[model samples]
Target: MRLRRSARIRGPGGSFLRRPPLRVNVASPIELRPSPDGRFLACGDQVGWLRERGYGVDSDGCRALELYEALYLVERGDAAALGADGAPLDVSGLISLGSKRNPRFLTKYIVYRDLRNRGYVVREGYGLGNDLRVYRRGEYGSRDARYLVVALEEGRRMSASTLGRIYLRALNLGKELVLAVVESHGDVIYYSVSQFNLRRRLDDAA
Candidate 1:
């Protein structure tokens, strides 16, 4: 299936996309990461830093931060109380926290988790010469499923067919037997549903 509607995502990490006619409730730039390697950008809303203010403030930001942390824990397949971000929500005496506040950690964590659940064998950092890579289960040869070759845009526009070929070759699929796309925008993420068959395309080409 195709992406039903594109989300309105823009900022430092995104190239110029045709702006949507209507506004959408999209997360701000702070919510997204430029790449997995740039791990220093912080996205918390100042709740975790209140302890530095020195005693007696309500620490409401701490509560929201804890909530987000709890959500992240659930997404990471950890038990709800493992305390992925803050101290154990159940305990009252200790407050363990992450030294860095970059929200990109959460973004990468979510993307990897979602793709893994979608039956893709995901490779996190660049793979086999491709900047990013994904594969469907089954034999490696014969190009039996779709793959995405992710790229940041350059000045010129490239055709979809070119992208499809690059993805196939980078993943060692040999020829034009795979479904692929060059996803240009970093923030506008895409997910594939495996109902589409690459074997059908290879067979059609043959």
Candidate 2:
């Protein structure tokens, strides 16, 4: 934008300054739709802030929101999921459909919502139904993903091999591995995981 040399008028020898801009915060609901493949929710300009805030991935000229992201936005009163029928889906309604779409939907949603509420930006993870990519509080969109989060339910048993693979993936991606456990009582607990070189430790001890 080009700055005006003078935004004034010679009225009564001197013109009064224009009224200051209204720097008020106005909340507008965002609109979104399911992608053609039904795997993601497509949004246009309404998702600009969401994209900047690391909500979804880019698809053509729009951003695609996953079920968990959509649910979070709906619950936050910032977005609405418009169905094919052109009607918006309510939070409870979306949860019902989401559960059917993915068996671990609630667990994933719980972790995702909690992370967002805790001031982190979360994006899709490397593994489906396994993890999420997270950014530090103020580093989203400007820095690499800081955490590779693996979501699990309390009391659920995961094979060590599977965890090893996830750890390797995070290591290769140069991110810290985090395990997010959702308790039966609907609380999320986070634990940081990292590789420990036992051989090196043993040699040092010897």
Best by lDDT: 2
lDDT (C-alpha) at residue 139 in model 2: 88
Backbone clashes in model 1, listed as residue pairs: 41-102, 42-101, 47-61
| Alpha-carbon RMSD, candidate 2 | 15.3
lDDT per residue for candidate 1 within 130-159, as digits (tens), equals 233445554323343345534322233445
Residues 60-105 of candidate 2 have per-residue lDDT tens digits of: 8777888778777776667768876877886676777787877787
TM-score of 1: 0.28
lDDT of 1: 0.32
- TM-score to native of every candidate shown: 0.28, 0.78
| Deviation (Å) of 102 in candidate 2 | 1.3
- Which whole-number lDDT from 0 to 100 does residue 4 have in model 2? 15
Root-mean-square deviation of every model: 15.3, 15.3
